[model samples]
Target: MTDQLPLERLALWVEKRPDAVWLSQPVNGQWHDFTWAQVDEQARRMASALQALGCAPGERVALLAKNCAEWFIADLAIMLAGLVSVPLYPLQSAESIDYVLRHSQCKAIFVGKLDEPDKLAPGIPAEVMRIAMPYPTMAAQYTWAELLAAHQPLHEVHRQSAEQLLSILYTSGTTGQPKGVMLSAGAFAYAGSQSVREMQITEQDQYFSYLPLSHAAERFLVEMNALYSGGRVAFVESLETFASDLRHVRPTVFFSVPRLWTRFQQGVLEKLPQAKLSRLLRIPLIGKLVARKIRKGLGLDRARILVSGAAAIPRALLEWYQSIGITICEGYGMTEHLAYGCFNRPGQVRFGTVGKPMPGNELRIADNGEILLRCPSLMLGYYLDPEKTAETITDGWLHTGDKGEVDAEGYLKITGRVKDIFKTSKGKYIAPAPIEGEIAKNLWVEQVCLMGSNLDQPLALIELSPAAREQSQEQVTADLAQTLQQLNAKLEAHERLSHFVVVREAWTVDNGCMTPTMKIRRNVLEARFADQLGELDARQPLHWQ
Candidate 1:
């Protein structure tokens, strides 16, 4: 084992297994493989070409693209050239992209094939070198082909120290502007290696990459883990073909957000309406055969690990997947720690709790019940913001804004976000996230935003399922009303939702309702729907009936 960090790890792997497939992309209805040697050479050329453009050490290079082979090549090249890499969420609005680029002072950008580059191009700084990859774009930018053609490789030299800044990930805050979390090369390498151990990743494991790489969860868990373990990584062609791509890859280790897992649960449930179909299929003579068929059709038959995170997953949803012979392990972490904080072990899987902290990581509750974490993987600080950084990181503990409690066995049970909890006019503090997590168990309720902040009662904004909307409006409303009544009974008076509004549209990253990790933007949703929720107060709590 060498002392080389992550970038060096990639180079060493490529040198050892030059011809091994490092990445795969779907092309012409087939998966195309790119060997390790190919990736190494491509990234080297890109780095050298970037240097020719006067890119300097510690300068930022922004990558705006989906999960493609080029994304990884560009990322590695950035670090290899002793520059910082800032990955933008691919589905971000031009405005958000411009914000990140400007905030990070990115000197160059590498964008993937986009439907509309002109819209995003104008906002970028004129002095920045814009390079579009694997697709045609406007003339001011250099195509990826042109970038490589301009390569002038440098002699072998390791220019990075362990303490050098690796990347600056911008995460939205509850307050005014977003904060850029500055992380070091040591942080990524340490966390990535620890993840490989905790997740039990191996060279034989293949990963299907669909999640946005801009999110630290996917970047550390999938992208960086692939480099650490030499596993073949495959990118889905598009969201439309995600199912087909899964079947094609038969990936051993699969990662998804809680929302996607809910959809999968709902998709499976769609086949069996309300236990009537389940009863018919559960007969001793047919149960095994039917269950086997269901598993095979969903392409989950070969999946060894189907991990979900980036948001709290409901226990009810986990039980639903368990019934289908799929174990959904839910973990918890954030961008500041290179993502892996706590995860349940394979067999010791527990529902509703983010299991024991990874080795070398310590978790504790602060005086105010906020979750505090201490780890070598913790980010250095907020970029150029010493005051905010000092406030967040005190005495080696990263003050995670989340409130959690540790059980006797040391499992961390996330209660709610300290900043997100709303106080009702009744003087009762209600945490809406747990209630939202429970209501999300309803298959027809696709995505939910629970709002009550400084209000008398809470209201839920529900994005209905397609199947739910296909029913007559009266029937859809009736069923959801019944669900709300039952769910409300389980909550305290202040915690119960006063009314529900069903939205036909889905909350997605492209729409600015969700983040790159598929986490609902609470502040944005609250601002957008505050008045609409206030209108719900006219009706009584049980008025939905």
Candidate 2:
């Protein structure tokens, strides 16, 4: 791996292959490409603009927007000016944005291509300089293009050290208050280099930039990795048209949360009804043709590696995709570790395990079964939270709050979160993640949350597949009963799912049912359905459709 930092690598790329297309964007149904030279020039101009506007080096500059060309430009500008970049999730609640901005102490922010700027404007502090991308329609405090055109270019490199603060990424806050993870150029350089090697990212690889860049995984996978490897990064036009955009790009490598993968499965099944599905399965030639068509239509045909992380993927979905010629390698990591810790090797992949730790990272299970990791990928420390930082990293090993064990072949199998394990009133400990993974293996069960805290046996909150809901209510009920009965037989007395509640409404990030990474927020789910779950227990062992 190169010892050069991420910014250094970008500078080198800009100098060497200035004309290579580094970023691709689709605006107004038209695809646009930007070369490294174009990106560097624009970034420098933006940096000059910020400097002219009384922005100082080492100050925090936040970028509040979705995935777009401007996000990259703003980030590079921040780096160029030797400022720390804090990316805020555009889809998050106003309260979340406010918390991150205040915590990071951002003096200036760029809100780019927002669908609801009016809602966000109320949350911004009057003291903070609010800048809008391109031109403003919502009348933000400042505009981007005008500032860039008036300011003199600053071409001199800021020359940041390895320990200099590069970014301050706020956590998704699935639990409580979000902690800003402070990362340095050295830390990200080491982490991104290792990730690039593990992911086998090459210049030929094309990545779809759809996930929230505010998240570590996507930022590293799409942005940092793209710069290091000279790979092309494509931004989806919008969330509503992500599927269409994916088809247009046909990215060689796609990164998605498990939730999107579930939707992809539903889309394929919906197009081919059960009758047609059965008939196609019967004819070998036709089955292959139909499956290929389905994969291509979902923009997964050319995908050399379809990765899902930030949450556990259902083992069933893994197997199903494998059956259709697409190999999904699930990874396991946290924000504190710079996103990737262990990823299943390209060919030597496993369905149920998160694979062995990547090179330069150590993984061991503590006596109590907590997954422990020590790596260069580790963050410098949490911003302004020394107590928490010290507690998280002990003896150089980050005590990942997850419980898991390494298999004989060195594969790491995550059991569940240490705090997420619940005890039944009967005093039996129940791990919901593994049980949910077992149930979600069924194609019909798109999403499941196991609920058993202070109960006799566990019950599941299940979201149905699109194809499953198309069936008659009687058919759906009968199918659920049979599937549950079979699933129960596979589990021990304490682990068996006793009842299932069908959730008609889909869980989404916008709906607050899921995180930006598509992981179900268990604490939120439990709180929201506390009364409903109590009603399910009153009629214990009952299934609701």
How do the predictions measure up, each by TM-score? 0.94, 0.95
Error of 2 at 184 (Å): 1.1
Q: lDDT per residue, candidate 2, 143-261, as tens digits?
A: 87776777655689578778888999888767888888988888778877777777778889898998888899988878888887889999998778888999888998888888778
Evaluated against the true structure, the overall lDDT of model 1 is 0.81
Pairs clashing within candidate 1:
none
lDDT score of residue 236 within candidate 1:
86
Give the distance in Å from residue 519's predicted Cα in candidate 1 to where it truly belongs.
2.1
- In candidate 2 the C-alpha lDDT for residue 57 amounts to 90
Q: What lDDT score belongs to each candidate, Candidate 1 first?
A: 0.81, 0.83
Candidate 2 yields a Cα-based lDDT of: 0.83
| lDDT for each residue of candidate 1 in 499-543, tens digit (9 for 90 to 100) | 887765678766668765677888888888776666554654423
